[model samples]
Target: MVARSLLALCLAAVAAAHGDHGEQKIIAGPLQSLWYNRLPGDGGTQADSVFSGISTFGRLPYLPCLSHKDITYDIAFIGAPFDTGTSYRPGARFGPSGIRQGSRRLNLYGGYNVPLETNPFNSWATVIDCGDIPVTSYDNTYALHQIEEGHYSILSRSPATDADKKGPSLQGKTLPRVITLGGDHTITLPLLRSINRAYGPVTVIHFDSHLDTWRPKVFGGSPSEVASVNHGTYFYHAAQEGLLRNDSNIHAGIRTTLSGPSDYENDGYCGFEIVEAREIDTIGTDGIIKKIRDRVGTENPVYLSLDIDTLDPAFAPATGTPETGGWSTRELRTILRGLDGINLVAADIVEVAPAYDTNAELTTMAAADALYEIMSIMVKKGPLSGLEVEAGDDL
Candidate 1:
């Protein structure tokens, strides 16, 4: 009874907090207007220009893209939409669409002092939701190769159209800004490989219940085992390939399980620096931010990967793996917000399997909220410079 009462109180508090806008009006101008009431059909031509720049996923305005062509996208929200890599359950491929559906209801004008929705910072930026990358196969390996090849092709600037020559050319034009929606964690392998080629090494902010560094051999097969490369061993392969600088570069959250100690020792794994959700509660969000900053440095390019299971089952239950002790939505938001100054290059929100969620609430909300946080950060950081979307003027 006490627990139920506490939950009720917490819900009430959140509602009150969200509703306490006081006199803050819902200004609806161009979706870009700073003033609260600039509705979409306002008379200003600039408003239409701004609206056209913004991309929509389902109903919510996703990343804004300036153009689309030559496979160029400043912020491509590609949906992997396949979870075959998962060892425990299958269904994360549904994540992208679910998230897009949920995002439709989100208000573009964030209230209060939220930095992402503010003007000046957001005015010059171009973010876009390029929709899902087309994948014809359900087979994990085939799908991964397709994803890798597709990104490689899109990023390459070489004039060669032949498959043989195109391979090397595509490698040359890889953009630095991309946000992939996952079929599962394993998909990150190809995505990271693409990013590594473009930006070199990067630090990863991994939020999940497991370290995800276990080798496929530990699970009784070689790394080539499709199941091994699935959600469980992506980081392991990344580390082996020298993508991560060290274990310190990978900061994990809410880890309560391990493949074993031998795996940690053999590779000089530093282990998760931060463990236990309660520790976050005690040290406070700012403290966690400081820890991340200290490790990755303020200027190092960082990638954030959020596994929905990182949130407590109560808040995000539609995941292949659900862990009890984890972060709440508010806590996760605080953490992302605190990392504002860091050089976040690319990010992904994964492992949201909506089929398991009858209400479609868990994966949907988590995915949209995660993207919102990432977009918030990007808007504050300024235009990704050379990585603009490639679309005809008609878009």
Candidate 2:
């Protein structure tokens, strides 16, 4: 009887602690008029604080770009989270989410980019963060196809703004641009292939510490073709497959040790003009900008691929391969800002391995800021025009 009485008292206390599970009324305070019908701060929801909500790139709205054909956007941020192609460290598979986490503070205070004078989020374009591609870790070939198809799906769509239709287009329609959060440098091959279908061949502005145009036999002999496709040699495959425009592509910040002078010869044959990292000391950022602009020119559709390791280990130590002497974050951002009028179609920032990042998230934050600059430029210059999308091109 005593035990039963104690159990009854405990049950009563638990119920009281739980309280009523119903719609409870919120007491309107003295300042209720300020927020009565209006949404909370920044006009976002009451529960839409950056620290609490589902994280997307820049905390932008999420859309299933692949599944939904009806929802059109001008710019879409997509994640390709596969790192099997990495030659050195391997945590870049989580690069997409890590970049999103680092981008939380973007546009939080105010979505304005003063340098280029364009606000991507609030501009004429409809921007959305399309969630990552569902790439399988078990199969590299499958993952490659997945990333390519996901990119093409977004690239082939017409922009939400009908006014953008007057711009240059190979498809005869103004298509939306994609800013891909990368898995590794190897992802560039499929991206180029997709871009080829949309715009015959594009100038590549590659920023990295190493030349990625190594022949598979030169990089390391692979037993199979699939095995040969890796971060270091994808550009070789891209060149062989005719995804690049000759005499226009350029590589910046290259300081990696090469096998021999033949490697530089091979890089040149692949249609890339090299700008060594040490050149920044003499040429300055402006010189580097002039070289890139001169090489890429003002007409052709250009693809900008920035590997996080292009920054020195001191600034971006979390990447797969860190070189000691590289461009500072500010220097790289300044270079990017200078390429404002070029026809930049689609771009990617790859090799950001957040597992190797410091508590400060230096690498991921730097990558995010670099992307912010790229976004600003793309917004400043609308959809790429004057190119024709080659039809029925085999990949």
Candidate 3:
């Protein structure tokens, strides 16, 4: 038996070598004689046959428009390819394409035994990749309006009973979770608006280098006024509009500088917990997780907004805004992984501009990987399962 096994292993190795070269190599060993199997690539087909018919790595199904019937998927991935709102960089509008290309090599199944396909209920949940949202050219107002419309369309038809035909109104169905791939951080404004209209109030997990609370920075009457609607001050608008409740609903990560204190503390503004790089370094990932849970609560609906600049510039330099010191990628991953109990309702990865990247690959990859980490959590924990309450439960 041992000799037969050794002969089989040797024949398999030889077959692999021949297949790599697009050639056919037959073996006439005793093992082959007993099995009577055909030689590798003996059918005159291309040697790439082994990989044919399989889905491309990370290439998810694309459904651009959302109808009432298509809300069964647990998560919908949408891309926002606009970046005119960037404060420091000008090319983030290309973020979605770059991230898609970068993520081409990642498999849907977990890599290295990670089991990413498993869901919170121990059953696989449907995750669909909706294509990028169409953005108007060089107009932040138009772009914001477009994204808002798109999100509302999805939310309106989110809970469909039939997978083939459009179902009745979602008067009693759950909404589909929306995961956006952003052109820049500014896109979050409209997204937040849509969520606020639907869910009332939700916690925001913001990862960035700057506080992004400059209200007047781009408010002047100039061509740049539209630019004010960009990424640097999105959170300011969200808080000012009462989307983010001023008490413990917002958590800022890796903050190195404040855009301005008054911007954060003005009357009627929502309160937020800013976790500076110094504090994160001191308390570590475990402590940060505890703090986040304490503030957002384990069951509250949460939105995760990750800007690639939250990582140290050394590791993620492809962003339009790169800070000198910030959290490491591994540390950020650990923090995200630890949030398994938090109900992640919606999420986005923004500010990835490939033009600023020397490698043209790292920034989008970082964003895509961060997105994957979030998706893995959603799959494992189910969409806000632990956070949602029964209809009769007390608030």
Give me the candidate number with maximum lDDT: 2
- Candidate 3 per-residue lDDT, tens place, 253-333, comes to 655555345645641255677677667768988888777778777655677888889888777888887888788888888
RMSD of 3: 10.5
> How far out, in Å, is residue 90 in model 3?
1.1
TM-score-best of 2 and 3: 2
| RMSD, one per candidate, in order | 13.2, 10.5, 10.5
lDDT per residue (tens digit) for residues 1-395 in model 2? 22223333544564566565212121222101111122424543343356665678887766677887666777889999989999889999889999999988887766688888888767766777888988999999999999999899988877776635444455456777899998999999989988888777778999999999998988867778998999999999998989898878999999999889999999988999999999999999999999999999886678999999999989999998788899999999999999998888899999999999999999999999999999989888865544434333321
Candidate 3 TM-score over all chains jointly: 0.76
In model 1, which runs have C-alpha deviations exceeding 4 angstroms?
1-68, 71-73, 108-122, 136-138, 153-176, 220-224, 266-275, 358-360, 385-395
Give the best candidate by TM-score.
2
Once fitted onto the true fold, the runs of candidate 3 whose alpha carbons sit more than 4 angstroms away are 1-57, 66-72, 108-123, 159-172, 217-228, 259-268, 383-387, 390-395
Tell me the lDDT of model 2 at 128.
Answer: 76
lDDT of 1 by residue, 136-188 (tens): 44577788877776554443322111222211112323243567777688877
Q: By lDDT, highest first, what's the ranking?
A: 2, 3, 1
For model 3, the local distance difference test gives 0.64
Error of 2 at 297 (Å): 0.4
